[model samples]
Every structure is written in structure tokens, then in C-alpha cells.
Target: MPPATPPSPARRPGYGERRGELVQAAIRVVAAQGIAGLSHRSVAREAGVTHGLVRHHFGTMTSLIAEALDTILPQSLRRNPVSLLLADPGYPEEDLVSWIDEQADLQVFEYEVLLATRHTPELRPLAERLYRGYEDSVRSAFAEHDLPAPADAHVTLILAAIEGLVLHRVTFRRDDGPTITAAFVALREAIRLAVAADGAPST
Candidate 1:
């Protein structure tokens, strides 16, 4: 019987695939228990892999945290309403709300990391990159829609408002869908009006 075809070598995951799994596990651990709970063993347990395997993929916890942020930042941006609108102006608000609901854990993870930066100076750069990613996405969305480039302060305020809304929704746990959706809709309309007003010629 051809020696049972050598059992097909047990079909191990590709290197990149395994690394990705570890990163996702790290995010989940941080999301559930905050950054203080993240360790090689914790991630290994979360991913159902050996701790050595996690270390092999990421030499240190810092590396693992960085990779987790790197992986999640794009994911968060891609699902962001502003980014979605930039990609497809017709993207539904309902869909955005659904995506937000589904990604609550990811949002929690992000905030955990951002807060951790206060005590972990090494993480400050990663936090800066995270904010820069959001800022770039917002700037791109504004340009894509022909809105005037907002001042740096205005962009910062926009990010603060959106981030605050997301935090309130995820943290409170009781914020209803309609309320969250309405808040997002109002924020988007407000942004458009503000940008248009900035661009309009003085009467």
C-alpha cells in the first residue's frame, strides 16, 4: 500500500501561518486580561501550541506585542467606517456597526496597549505608530472625498471623538446598536459639514 504514503508528513502549518496564529493568540490574551497577562506561555496556551514554538517565532514578549499590534492595526483600520467610506462611499453604516460589534475585542486590545504605554516606555513608539495609522487613514479619507485637509488639531480632535465613542461602546457594554449607529452617523455628518465649511469661500 506504498507504506501509507508516509502519513503525509502530518501537514504542519507554514511558518508564516504559525506566526500569525501566535500573534492572534497574543491579541486575544491581551484583550481578555490586558497586557500584564501576556506571556509566551499564555499565548501558547491560547494558540494550543508549545511555548517554545511561540518563542521561536517571536524571540521576546516585546517582539510578540509589536507583531500583534502590527497585525491588528491594519485590521482595525480596514474595518473603520472612515476607511470603509474612503474605499467605497456607499459602504453601509449598518455594516460598519456590525463590524464594530464583531471587533470589540480588538478594540479592547488596542486600548490596553495604548494605556500600557504610560508605564512601558518601550511601547510608546508602537502606540505612536498606531495613532499614526489612524491619522493617515482619516487623512486619506478626507482627501478621497475632496474635503479640505483638516488642520492637525482638527484631525486630532476627530480621532479623539471617534476613539472616545468606540471606548464608550466597548467599555459600557450596554450601549445599544441604534445609539452607537446614530452616534457614528452624526459624527460622519459633522465631519463633512466641518470640512465643507472650512473649504467654502467667505460670503
Candidate 2:
């Protein structure tokens, strides 16, 4: 008889790093397949580990998805409004073009997440939280321009327009960055001017 081979040691790193990788893998899988297609086995396979590894780390599907959302949502926010605001903290009029570019890039990723969320319960809260944080940030950024503030509906509309533009560009057209940014810059400036002149959030 051939000599018995010893079992291989687990290649996974320490808890924190391994967990982070698993979460990231979950994001990729979700992006590619949507929530309906995700499973512990699939994510584990994507991460090059066993299904047991995913279960061991995440415990439940909901918990795992939530953690994944936590990781992804922040980046989504950063990609658009967050990064745009960060680039020009003093709100330089000349930098509006740059802000629009950043925002458009951010929207591409956001729409992907939104598509995934449609089928994943774990992603609902994540989406909600992202919207909340985004709205707050938009309000703050407008406030910085010596504006009163936008109502939730107005903020939602602006966000929707940015996202809708990205989705349309992705689905029906090519990379329309310059055109989209020009439109967004004009709209954002108009909003800022309106808010400033009104001296309060519009209802």
C-alpha cells in the first residue's frame, strides 16, 4: 500500500484578513451574479476556499451578505459624491468638471450594487444606508456652498439623475463622460444657486 498522505493545512490567513477577502469576493460574486446566484459555496469557490470556510466565517447568509454590503457601500459612496466633494473642499467653480467626472465614475459602481440588491435581502439595508449617507453628504456639500439645503426629494432626484445617466450610458451608449459631466455640473450649480437664493430647503 502507498504511504498515507497528510492533510493539507488551511491556506487562509488570520481572521481579519481572511474575513476581508471573503467579503470582497462576495462583492465580486454579487456584482457578477446578483443576490439570487450567490451562495456560500460559490463565494468560497471564488475565494479559493471551501464552503465550510465561508460558513465558518460568516455563520449565516444574511450576516455574510450584510458584512459584504458594509464593505461595498462605503466604496460606492466614495466613488461619486464623496470623492467629488473631497476633491474640491472649498467648492472651486473651476473644479466642477472634475467633480462631475468623479461622480459619474461613482455611479457606474453604484448601479451594479443596486442591481445585485434587487435579489438579495442582505443588500436592502446596505442600499438604504448608502442612500442615507449619500443624501446627507449631498446636503452637507450644498450647505458648504452657502446654500440653505435640499429636501430629501430633491436630493433623491439628483442622485437618481446621476445614476440614471450612468445606467443609460452603460446600456445604450458609450462612455459619455464629458456630456454627462457637463449636464451634471450645470444642474448641480443651478441647485446650489437656488438653495442659496431660497435660504432653506425646498419642499
Candidate 3:
């Protein structure tokens, strides 16, 4: 008989992979039902695993939430139009709309967590840390472009404007890509104008 085929590699997910799946499931639950609806059972159901598995991976609700935030923070920054624009000044506004459309659920989940912070003081730290991550990315992007980084307040305003646009798009289910692209273009121009005005020689 032909030598037995090498034993099939273990098909089971590793510990870290299972934890990541649970975190993604948690995000989906929060995105669809808000943070109040998130429970180990809900996430386990979404992930096609048992609640016991979720608990084994995350140990506590707060820990799971925090882990979800940690996972999403980097994702948010990477997918954020501001970060994209900073990294590629010539990145098209139309692409911004496309990116938003593609990541609408993730954006919604981020907003849910942010809104939750209003009544859940304990979550404020995580939310603040998330914002700081964005701010830091903005600064780094500015530096990479050989531009002076805007003040923290300016950075905050810029990010807020982008977030507002994203909220509007996702909330309204706006499918008018051109209209959204125009808005993003306007925002991008406004940022450029602000930087230019700041750097201009004194009158």
C-alpha cells in the first residue's frame, strides 16, 4: 500500500486565533445591538462557539470589551480617511467614500463603544485611549510629510469632523458616493487651508 499520507495537520484553531474570533464576534454583536446587548452568550452564538469558550478566553465582560477595543483601535486608525489622507496626500476623495462603505459596520461598532462611554464611566479610559491613538497617528503622518503637526485641539477637531461624516453616512445608509466624496473633499481642503494659513508669513 502507498505509504499512508502524512497525518493531516491539526485543523483546529490555535488559542490566539479563537480569541481573535471571539473578539470579532463581540464587535459584530455590539455593532448590531449596541454594547448593552453584548454578553458571552451573544458573542459565542455569533462566533459559533459556546459561552464557556468565550468566558475561558476573556474571563470577564470588562476584559472582553477591553480586548475588543484594543483590537479595533488599530483597525479604526488604519481605515480612517484622515490617516489615509495623511499617508497619501493625493489619495482620492472617492476612495474615502469607498473605504467608509466597506467598513461601515466597524465604524458603527466604534461609535457604539464611544457612545457607551457617556454612561459607562469605566469605559471612558478605553475610549480616550482610542482617540489618543488616532491623534498620535495624525501627528506621525504630519511628521512623515515634513509638515508641522497641528495642535492637539486642531487634531481633535479634524478627527471629530471625520467621525461626524462617518456617522452621518452609516446612520442614514447614504449610498450617494459622489455626495459623500464631495463632503470628504471639502474636509480635506479645509484641513489643507488651515495648515496653509498657519504656515503663511505674518501679514
| TM-score of each candidate structure, all chains considered together | 0.88, 0.68, 0.90
Question: How would you encode candidate 1's per-residue C-alpha lDDT over 1-203 as one tens digit per residue?
Answer: 45555445577889999999888899899888888999989999999999998989988887887888888878887665675544445566667667777888889989998899999999999889878988987888788777787768768878887788788878887847788777777777777666777678878
* Residue range with the least summed lDDT across 10 consecutive positions in model 2: 82-91
Which tens-of-lDDT digit does each residue in 1-203 have in candidate 2? 99999999878588999999888777667656656657899899899999999999998867876676566556655534523533444344334444434444334435666676777666677778777777777777666555556667677777776566556655554656567666656666655554565564448
Off by over 4 Å in 3: 1-10, 86-89, 201-203
Better of 2 and 3 by lDDT: 3
Worst 10 residues of 3 by lDDT: 80-89
How many residue pairs clash per model?
A: 0, 0, 0
RMSD of 1: 2.5
User: After best superposition, candidate 2 residue 13: deviation in angstroms?
Assistant: 2.8
Model 1's TM-score against the true structure: 0.88
Candidate 3: C-alpha lDDT: 0.81
Superpose all Cα atoms of candidate 3 onto the true structure and report the RMSD in Å to 1 decimal: 2.2
Q: What is the lDDT of residue 157 in candidate 1?
A: 74
For model 2 the local lDDT of residue 10 reads 75
Clashes of 2: 0
lDDT of 2 at 137: 72
